[model samples]
Target: MPAPRIKSPALLVAESGADREGHGLRRTLGRFQLVCFGIGAIVGTGIFVGLSDSVAQAGPAVVVSFVLAAVTCVFTAFAFAELGGAIPVSGSSYSFAYAGLGETTAFLVGWCLLLEYGVSVSAVAVGWSQYVDELLHSLTGLNLPHALAAGPGDGGVVNLPAVIVIALASVLLVRGVRESARATAAMAVLKIAVLVAFCAIGFVAFQDGNLSPFSPAGLGGIGAGTTAAFFSYIGFDAITTAGEEARDPRRDIPFAILVCIGVVTLLYCAVALAAIGALGGDGVGDRPAALSHVVNEVTGSAVGGGVIAFGAVVAIASVVLAVMYGQTRILMSMSRDGLVPRVFEKVSPRTATPVAGTLIVGVVFAVPAAFASLDSVVNLCTIGTLATMVTVNIAVIALRRREPDLARTFRVPLYPATPLLGIGFCLYLIYETGPATWFQFAVFLAAGLLLYAGYGRRNSRLGRGGDQGLTPGDAGRVRQEA
Candidate 1:
C-alpha cells in the first residue's frame, strides 16, 4: 500500500474554499453571532456544576485555581487564534495537524476530539439533570426519583432527563445554524444575567474570614483543581469548529476565540469569589448545587435559588447545543477527507446542515447520558482537550516555519514563545490529571491507530489521487440534493 501523503497547507485552504462554494455548508454566521456561539459553549456546566468540586479540592485557593486554569487556557487560546485565522476550517486542530503534521497524526487528533466532544456533551447533560432536579424540588417540593435521575453507579436506573435534553439540543441543531445560534445567544444572555445576580446578591453577605487560609490545600491542591477547572474552558475551541459557517471566518473566528476566553475567565473568577466569600470553601464546595445554594444561604430566598437553578439548566442546554454542533462539523470535515464515512459530510438541502450526521452523533451520546455516570468523563475531557491544545500549539509553530507566506488574519503575539508556553501549560495540566488519565488517553490513541490502519489509511482521498472527492455514498446524496 502506498503511504498517504501529507496534505499541503495550500491544498487544505483550497479544499476548504471549495467546500464553501460547491454544494457545501452555508456561511450564515457573523462576528457577533460567532462570539455568542463561543460564550454559550464556554460558560456552562464547569461553572454551574463543576466549580463545587474544584473548590473542594483546592479550598479557598480554588479562586487561584480558576486563575491558573485561565492562564493555561489563555496560552492555548492564543495558539488557537493564530491557527483559526490561518486555517478557518471546521476540523480545527485535526485539520491543522493534517496541514502541518500528516494524516496519521491528524486522524489521532480527530479521534481524540470525538472523545472530547462526546464525553463533554454527556457530562454536561449529567450536570443539567442536577439543575433540573434542583429546580423541580425548589418549585414544587418534589424531585426526580433516584432511579430515574441518577446514573447506574449512583444506584439509578437511568438519567432520563439527560437524554431528553440532548434530544432537544439535537432538534435545534437540525433546524439550522442560524436558529441554533440565536437560541444559543438568548440562552447565553440568560446565563450571564443569572451569574451577575449571583455575584450581586452574594457580596451582600461577604465575610473576610471565609477567605482565610486561602491555600489550605497548598500548591499541589491548586494544581489539581486547575486541571479540573480547565474543563470549563474546553468549549472555546468549539468556536473554531464553526469556521466554515462564519461569514468572515479568517477574521471572526480568531477574534471570537480570544474574546470568549477573556469573558469566560472573568465570569469564572467572579463567581468563584462570590461563592467562597459568601459561605467559605467548605460551605460552597461540598454541595451539588453549590452556586444556587450559596445564593439561598446568603439571601435566604428560595426564589433566588430557583432562579439560579433555571439559569443553570439554560447554561447546560446551551453547552449541549454548541458541543453537539461542533462534533457533527468535525465529523463532517474528517468525512470529507475520506477518514470516516462520507455520510457525515452530506448536508441536507432543506436545512443546510448535516442532518443525518447530527442525528447519529446525538443518539450516540444520548444513550450514555441516559445510562452512564460521566463524572469521571470530566477529567477525560480535560486531558483530551489539553492534548489537542498541545497539538494546535505545535501546529502554529510548524505552519509559521513551513508556510511563512500564508496570510494570517491574526498571529500569535510573541510567536514561538507563546506557543511554547501553551504547550508547557497543557503538559503541566495533563500531568496534574495523573497516571489514570494518561492510561485512558493512551488506550484511546491506540484504538484510533487501529481504526485508522484498518480503514482511514486505505481510503484517504489524497491516496486515491483526488482532492475532496466525494465517496460513492456522498456522490449519490449530492445528486439527490441537486
Candidate 2:
C-alpha cells in the first residue's frame, strides 16, 4: 500500500477558496456571530452545573483551578488561531493535520473530533434535561417523573427532555447556518446576562469568612479541580470549526477565539468566586443545582432560582446547537476527503446546509443521551478534547517548519514555547483524568484505526490519485461537482 500523503499548504488554501465559491457552505458569519458561537458553546453545563463538583474537589481553591484551565486553553487557542487563519477550513485541527502531517494522522484527528463534539453534545443534552426539570418544578411546582426525566442508568425509561432538546437544535441547524447563528447569539446574550445576574445576587450575600482557608485540599485537590474545570473550556475551540463559514476567516476567526477565551475565563472565575463567597465551598458543593440554589438562597425566593434554571435551559440548548454544528461540519469535511460516506458532504441547495448530515449527527447522539448513562462519558469527551489540543499544538510546530512562508493573520506569541507548554499541560490533565479514561480513549482509537483501515484507506480520494492530474483549483472544482 502507498503511504498516506500530506496535503500542501498552498493546495489547502486553494481548495478552501473553491469550496467557498462553489455549491459548498456559505460564508455569512461575521466577528460578532463567531464570538457568540464560542460563548454559546462554552458557558453551558460547566459553569451552570459542574461548578459544584469542582468546588467540592478543591474547596475555595476552585477559582485558581479555573484560571489554570483557562491558561492551558489560551496556549492552545493561540495554535488554533494561527492555523484557523491560515488554513480556514471547516475541519479545524483535522484540516491542519492533513495540511501539515499526513492523511492517516488527519483521519485520527477527525475521528477524535467526532468523539469530542458528538459525545460532548450528548453529555450537554443530558445536563440540559436536569435544568429543564428544575425550571419546570420552579415554575409550575411540578416535576417530571423519574421514568420520563432521566436515562435508564438514572432510573428512567428515557430522557425525554434530552431527546427533545437535541431534536430542536438539529431542526434549527437544518434550516440554515444564519438562522442557527442568530439563535445562538441571542441565547449567548441571555445566558451571559443570567450569569451576571447570578453574580450580582451572589455578591450581595457574600461573606469574607467563606473564602477562608483557601486551597483546603492542597495542590493535589487543585489538580483534580483543574481536571474537572477543564471540561468547561472544551467548547471554545468550536470557534475554529466555523472557518469556512466566516466572512473573513483569517482575521475574524482568530479574533473571535481570543475574545472568547478572555470573556469565558472572566465569567467562569467570577461565577466561581460568587458561588464560594455566597455559600462557601461546602455549601455550594452540597447542592445539586448550585447556581440556581445560590440565587434562591440569597434572594429568599423561588423566583430567583426559577430564573436561573430557565437561563440554564436556554444556555445549554445553544450549546447543543453550536456543538452539533461543529460536528456536522467536521463530518462534511471528512466525507469530502472520502474518509466517510459521501452523504455527509452533500449540501442542501435550498437551505445551503448539510441537512442530512445534521440530522444524522443529531439522531446518532440523541439515542445515547436518551437511554445510556453518560456521566462517565464526560471524562471520555474531555480526554478526547485534550488529545485533539495536543495534536493542534503539534500541528502548529509542524506547519511552521513545513510552510515557513504561509501567511498567518495571528501567530502564537511565544512560538515553540507556547505550543510546547500547551502539549505539556494537556498531557498532565490527561494523566489526571486517570487510567480508566486513558483505557477508554485507547479503545476508541483502536476502533477508529480498524474503521480507517477497512474503509477510509480504500476510499480516500488522495490515495486513489484523484488529485494527481489536476491543479489545486481543478481538484476543488471536481470535488464540488462530485
Best by TM-score: 2
Structure candidate 1, residue pairs in collision: none
* Candidate topping lDDT: 2
TM-score of 1: 0.95
Q: Please give, for residues 49-101, the per-residue lDDT of candidate 2 as tens digits.
A: 78987998899999999999999999999999998888778888888889877
lDDT of 2: 0.88
Taking every candidate in turn, the Cα RMSD to the unseen true structure, in Å, is 4.6, 3.0
Residue 369's lDDT in candidate 1: 85
TM-score of 2: 0.96
Residue-level lDDT tens digits of model 1 in 1-482: 85536776556656666234554777889988898899998888999989988998898888889898998888889888877877777888888899887899899989989877888999999999999999998899899999999789668999999999999999999999999999999998889999999999888888999998898888999998898788888889999898788888878888899899998899999999988999998898768878889988877877899999999999989999999999998999899899999999999988989999999999999887888775768887888889998998898888888877766778898878988998999999999998998998999889999999999988898877888543554333212211
